[model samples]
Target: MKVSIIMGAYNTAPTLPVSIESILQQTYKDWELIICDDCSKDNTYEVALSYAKNYSNIRVIRNEKNSRLAYSLNHCLQYAQGEYVARMDADDFCLPDRLAKQVAFLDTHPEFAVVGGGVMLFDGKVVKKTIFNPEEPKKEFLARGVPFFHPTIMMRKSVYDILEGYWVSDRTKRGQDYDMWFRFYAKGFRGYNLQEPLLRYHDSLSDYAKKSSWDMTWGATKTIWLGFRVCKMPLRFYPWVLKPIVSWLLPKKLIYIIHNKKHNGKEN
Candidate 1:
């Protein structure tokens, strides 16, 4: 089956080349990459266009204005013409067999609508590898946290058709992917995460600090509340909705230490 990889680029000029090169070197050749530049001020558009110019399967689009990631992804979806839709970030690189393995899993498991894999976290140098190996994730799992890595996920085209893409509201702006997973689970669409690491996720402690900001915490809380209502989850889970708020209060150094502990301090 053919897979359409959708990516949104903002100010990722520095890492765009590596990200695109990883896609070009994928073991699965039956795929097309549709990247939308979200009015990046840097040379991200030029770099992506350079690759598209040479590769027939790579297509580049640009937003007239500075649209965010959610809007940009939905725009790319309009031009996608493949059985499966995969998500990619301009700042991350994928393993050679990432697409091939994901495609095989989806083809064999008809019940699953989405599939993601483990990721290797890096910051200039390798940090730690996080593995998410869940056979089937349900609403209960989502109540606590997002079980699937957004950029490492691949889903059926029908899932997008049913979910109508990510919720593009001010409340869900930062946690759009989290909101979408809850909505999908509410609709009885199951997901799985492969144990193997198939992507390199690059970020620093500063990025985590920004992600744990009050605004982002509020957005995540709203997403959880929406999920509880839409999925009919128990009211007891309401407190868990505000769990991310606590993370915002923690020190950045502590957060990094906790994250490192989770991965057993193993560097790739």
Candidate 2:
């Protein structure tokens, strides 16, 4: 049983080598890496192709126009031929044993449709903090936030086919993974978290819990409402739909100061 890793690469030219090198250095050798470049402004496609030249298991694709992650992932899925499909971020670092461990768990446990692990949030210089999700997260967990980290997840290829892959629309432009999670549970599938950091996620402290723009935040709020309908969540959990709105309304400096204080135990 082979695992196919699909990644959407944008303007990550400088980080591509290290991220791809992590995949090459994986303890599990029976895997293929499918990277779909999303018409990046930089030479991300060229960087990916350079690796495909030497590694037969690595495949590279490119979109004709600049689409978002949702479209890029769906395009990559068209060429994925594996028992399991793993998600990766172009700028993240994977642990050597991440693939082997995930494959082993999925091989024995047939009930769970997806599995993900904790992630170490880091910038270029230092690890900021570790976010570990619960072991068995039920649908109600959506009331707060995502149960599993997106880039750390590996799922049965059938699940993707059954759920019809990530939702590609204006509503999902900012929160594709979250919408997919809502649909995943609504369809009666189960998921698990390994409770250990399996990847180093690239999240700068300055960008913590902050959307780049008001439009993005509003889009996320839209996604939350859409997810609420998909999950058939109770009205009691409705307040969470306004979380992005509230967070976005706050001053950026205040948001950063609060986030920096919580994580670093002191204000930035």
Candidate 3:
């Protein structure tokens, strides 16, 4: 089956080549890469266009204005023509066999609408690896936090069709992936994360701070509330909805410590 990789590129010119190369070197050859540049001030559009020019399977699209990630993702989705839709980020790169393994899993298990894998978080050096639950992810799991990495996910094209693409709203600007997962769970769609780490997530302490900001906190809170309503979750799960707000209030250093503890001290 052919896989369509939808990547949103902003001002990631420094890492864009490596990111695109990772897809080009994938073990799975039957794939198309649709990279949509979000009107970056840098040369991101030029870099993406260069790749598209060299490869027939790769295409580059650009937003006239500086739309955010969700808008760029939806733009790429419009031109995707494959059985499965995979997501990529300009700052991250995947293992050569990542797509092969995910496509195989989805082909064998039709019940699962989405499949993602573990990720190795890195800065200048390898930080730590995060392994997701191998079993089907549940609504209870999502109540605590996102169970899968957004960029490492490969989902069925039908799943996107059913969900009608992402919620392109200002509310979801900072937490689009979180909102999308809740919608999937509410709709009774199941997902799984492979045990093996297949992607390299580039992040830093500053990035974590942005993730725990007021806007992200509010977005997560709103998404959880919507999930509860749509999925008919019990009131007991309401407490979990406060987690984002609580996390937002915590100091960035404390959050980093908690994150390090979760990943077990910066080792693969």
Candidate 4:
């Protein structure tokens, strides 16, 4: 089956080539890369265009305005022509066998609409730790962590048609994948995760800088509340809506400390 890998590019010009090169090295050849640049100020568009020129299977598109990830990815969906659609972030690196492995799993397990693998969190110089995803996401997973590593996911294209892509809104600005997962499970779609890490996610030591932003935290709170309503979850679970606010109140250093302890500088 053909696979269409859709990625939304922001101002990640310096790291874009490494991400694309990793895809080019994939053992699975029946795939296309569709990159949508969301009005980046840097040479991100030019760099994507350069790849498109060299590889016929790679296509590039640019948005006039800086639409966020959900809108940009929806734009990529318009040009996708594969039976499967995979997600890729502009700054992450995938293992050469990622696509091939995911494709093989999905081909045999037709019951699942989506499949993802664990992720090896990478700093600039070395891998920090590997995060293992659960083999199957539970119903309560919506109130907990992400059901799947967004970048390591490969999905049947039909899932997009059923969900109508991601819910584009203010809440989704920071947690689009969370909103999507909520709706996916609500609609009775199933997903699975491989036991091993398939991608190197670029999460620098300074990731706390991104997490400390109150604006993003508030957005996550709104998304969680929205998810509870969408999934028709119980009233008790509604209390979990305050989880983000509680997390936001913690000191940034404490947040990193808690993370390190949970993962223990090794596989989690």
- What does each candidate score in C-alpha RMSD? 2.2, 3.1, 2.2, 1.9
- How many clashes would you count in candidate 4? 0
Cα lDDT tens digits, model 2, 136-192, are 899888877788889999999999999999988876777789889999989999999
> Runs in model 4 with CA error above 4 Å?
263-268
What tens digits encode model 4's per-residue C-alpha lDDT throughout 168-206? 887677789988999898998999999889999987648
Clash pairs for candidate 2: none
2 or 4: which has the higher TM-score? 4
What lDDT is obtained when candidate 3 is compared to the true structure? 0.85
- Model 2, position 230, has a per-residue lDDT of 86
Against the true structure, what is each candidate's TM-score?
Answer: 0.94, 0.93, 0.94, 0.95
Worst 10 residues of 2 by lDDT: 259-268
Q: Write the per-residue lDDT of candidate 1 for residues 1-268, one digit (tens) a residue.
A: 3899999999999999999999999999999999999999999999999999999999999999986888999999999999999999998999999999999999999988999988888775774556554656667877667778899999999889899997777777577898888888878888988878889988678767657667778887777887889989987788887777777788878988777666421233
The residue pairs that clash in candidate 4, if any, are none
Best by lDDT: 4
Error of 1 at 13 (Å): 0.7
C-alpha lDDT score of every prediction, in listed order? 0.85, 0.88, 0.85, 0.89
Clashes of 3: 0
Off by over 4 Å in 3: 263-268
Measured by TM-score, how close is model 1 to the native structure? 0.94
TM-score of 2: 0.93
